[model samples]
Target chain A: MIINARYIAFWGCTIPALQPYVEKAARLVFGELGITLAEPEGMTCCPDPDITHMASHEYWLITAARNLALAERRGLDLMTPCNGCFFTFTEAISELKRNGKKANAVLSENFNMTFKGKVRVYHALEVLYDVVGPENIKAKFTRSLNGLRVTIHPGCKLLKYEEKRLDVKLYELTKLTGSTILTYGLERLCCGVPLMYLDADKAIELRTKPKLDRMKEVNPDAIVVICPACHNQLEKGQLMISEDEEYDIPVISLLELLALCMGFSPDDIGMYLHRIPADDALEKLGLI
Target chain B: MNEIHPLRKRFRSLPSSFKGLLRSELRIGHIYELTDLTVSDREDLGLPSKPPTAYSDPNALEALKRIAKATNLKKDTGFDVDKLDFEW
Candidate 1:
């Protein structure tokens, strides 16, 4: 058990608006694991890396700094499940530390905020693996996910900052649930989310289909993920592909998997809201 | 290429990105607005209908609006923030 296992939950735009089930599962899993995810008022978007950064580099930095300053004010570290938010925070924090004086001047002038660089940012996996050790997790597990076999989809941003070791953390955490992790050739490929804006059909066919086709060869029980964007892209992309092609692999968030092992029912974590019904996977776990 | 390109001559932004930015600037401080169905689903799941972030906090939206103004986002992107219009 880690001391002060609490963080300001940065629920990036995608999870709250598009996928609330992921949010619910996170809350349930964290609560069971004795972690406090405080939702402080007035925290805005991680500003969304895809659009905000592309629009204006300075605006993105100042906005992210302002959000970071909110957590700094409370003297608490921040964590997010969305890979996009994690990437933005890591990038913004790094840049702000270099130009701290200029960024703070803008924050203090406009928002009466200061980015003093007092806080640390983390992906939820870091909190799970690094902060709360594997020993604690092993002690807390009520049931084993021994028979369940799944493939991992560690989204693009997690791979960007290799030092974070998020990919290894994800694999180890899934292993804690006793699920077998199957490998696919295109595991490192993008989920085609960023390309969707340019051409939806081509995005699926080019980026997503190749990955799905490779994963299909192994025939896993579910596709596990940490980022909501990739989870949404992969699950939604399957339907967008040709009707003749069969790609019905259920995409499950990592938090939901841990929650199930901690003795929470599938419905407790809102697995019912999954785009690809987790019914087949749940049936395998004898959870249905 | 410029003449035939769907995104180049007109909006100069992807439709999804443009629409998402407009939504963030105008209403919710986040990209996608919390629809009624989502709200009901959240409540049914025993969580708050709206999370405590910008969706539920007016000050967060005000801060984002001010940040946009302070950083010259409107000028840089040529988005008419006042009228909530982006030239298509």
Candidate 2:
């Protein structure tokens, strides 16, 4: 199967900070698969978080519309990995498609630009799951992650955006590459990253603490995160909370795990960036 | 392309209150259906049956105390008092 190599690798604000490891792994794997990811110049912050909080409903529409316009101007479909960016782009595109004239008019007036209303935005997980087949990912695994237990936290944006509303199907994609997925009571709860900006204590209480407790019970070797925001929040939040508590499970990007299973070194995949060291797992795998 | 625009405009033009009603319906209309299973739901789903106990190591508490004190000092001093009070 031939996959098109024309899509833009859209990295919002968090990407530069959190995605070097995953991005490196992705390029290596995609190169092997004969797929090329293009990174366009002059792409700015998606402005989703800011617009959502500071702007009026109309202004939010224009802010997101401008991003879509920018991507469309590049003549490339936007492929975003950040859940917040994906939700904002997807929701903005959907809204504009639902109301193009008003949305385009507002965008034009605000940003001095017009959008053709013809770009498709995809979340990285969607690209990986649908475009890059799970069988292909399984085939890339030279090192089996046999005994290393993992828990997946599909942030609210990822699961909530799906049309069918099924949990098992949502989780099945993450469990595809022969790893034991730990199922815990608070599996579906938010990681509280979204609420961090609103109420830090409550968000921690409601989101991270519960997951930590649940993870301690299951004792997973690591936690797999899909969203960059969730990854940061889980890593920093876990470290902060662990200072008060005891368990210290490492948090990792899902792509990093895929790279590990494919026999990529910890340094090769940027595993050193993690707050909680994955050396214990690497030692167990004898890759250290 | 033209077909989608007008319908969306009309949809958005409805009274804000009417839109609120639609939003409410969208939020509450779904009644989730559950599948019948013989095993205990938690066991069948492999979900943890009980909440995990909290780990309270003394060293962790000391570290947390040090962090809290540092954070409090940072907050009180505003990280950079000169910058906070600066008039540029």
DockQ of each: 0.61, 0.02
Tens digits of per-residue lDDT, candidate 1, B14-74, equal 3665566655644687877889999999998998899887888888888877777777766
Best by DockQ: 1
Q: Which portion of correct inter-chain contacts appears in model 2?
A: 0.00
CAPRI verdict (incorrect, acceptable, medium, high) for model 2: incorrect
Compose the digit string of candidate 1's lDDT tens values, residues A71-172.
999989998998999999999989988887767888899878799888999899998898887778777789888999899999899999888789999999
Cα deviation of A95, candidate 2, in Å: 0.9
Residue ranges of candidate 1 with Cα displaced over 4 Å: B1-16
lDDT, residue B27, candidate 2: 23
Task: Compare the candidates by TM-score and give the number of the best one.
Answer: 1
lDDT of 2 by residue, A243-277 (tens): 68976788776767777777778877666656688
Q: Would you give me the overall lDDT of model 1?
A: 0.85
List the RMSD of every prediction in angstroms. 3.2, 17.2
